[model samples]
Target: MKLPNTAHTSRPWRIHEIAHDFLLEDVWALPTPGGPDDFPRLVRQMTSGSNTNDSRAYTALFEIRWRLGKLFGWDRPDAGIVARVPSLRDRLPADLLAGPRGPVFSSVPFTSVYQTDDEWVAEMANRTVHALMHMSWVADEGGGYHGQMAVLVKPNGWFGRGYMAAIKPIRYLVVYPALLRMIGRTWELQAAG
Candidate 1:
């Protein structure tokens, strides 16, 4: 479910340190409720792209976005991390840096940054924005843990800001809801198996 921005900002996440300059674009409470040990399972499912592929709308949107990006040089090498903006990994604390870097996504564009017992962070960058996807295992009030995902972004400039604004409705209305349903169904199947 979509959550208030404060749901992320109010938390004492380590991501806040490195992403202070970025805006909190979205916060969501994932439907994958389970035990603490299930975080790795959740992260694995996400990185594996098991949930996002089922939606035709998502596929179409992504295809169009990618084509547009290619045609406009919006994802060109010169506009990515270390070219346009430094990587968030560069700001990782020594302890986080020493731990296992998170899993590399199989079907997504993001690169893993860090992983811990309760949290994982990944990053993606393009001409439009430098973005971070953070996932955390949080204990629910009803007892048991569920996943929380947050998106943070630093838009490139006016164009980036406009791009984000233009996509906000589509993201909230179609992409995220579809993804949530997929994740929930996938999690149910995994748990059942």
Candidate 2:
């Protein structure tokens, strides 16, 4: 479910230190509820492209985005991580820097940054923005845990800001709801299995 930005801002996440200047574009409460030790499972399920089926709308939207990016040179390597923007990993402390960089993403264009016991960070950059995707395992009062996700982005300039504004509605309306359903189904299946 979509969450208030404060849901992320209130937490003392390591990402805050790495991407302090980025806007909190989104915060979401994932449906993957489990025990404290289950964070690795959640992260694995997420990075493994085969774990869940994507919504057709999302797939189509992604395809469209890619096409647009290609036509506009938005996804050139020179426009990515170290070329157009500094990598967030450059800001990591020694501990985080030496820790697991998480799994290789099977489908997305994101690069794994670092991972701790309860948190994982991945990043992607293009002409429109330098962005980070952060996931955390949050404990509930009942002693169980669930996942949370936050997206942080430093838009490149006026064009980037407009790009973000253009996509906001589709992201909130179609993309996120589809992801929520997909994750919920996968979590339920994991429990049943």
lDDT of each: 0.90, 0.90
**What local lDDT score does residue 48 receive in model 1, on the 0 to 100 scale?**
89
Alpha carbon lDDT at 192, candidate 1: 88
Candidate 1, residue 131: Cα displacement in angstroms equals 0.6
TM-score per candidate: 0.96, 0.95
Predicted structure 1: lDDT: 0.90
> 1-193, model 1: which lDDT tens digit per residue?
9899998888888888877898889999999999878999999999987773578898799899999999999998898888888888899999999998888889877889999898899998998999999999999998899999999998989999999999999998889988899999999988988
The alpha-carbon lDDT assigned to residue 94 of candidate 2 equals 96
Which whole-number lDDT from 0 to 100 does residue 55 have in model 2? 86
Clashing pairs in 1: none
Tens-place lDDT per residue, model 2, 64-118, is 9999999999999999999998889899999899889999999889999999999
Alpha-carbon deviation at 58 in model 2, angstroms: 1.4
**RMSD to truth, every model:** 1.1, 1.3
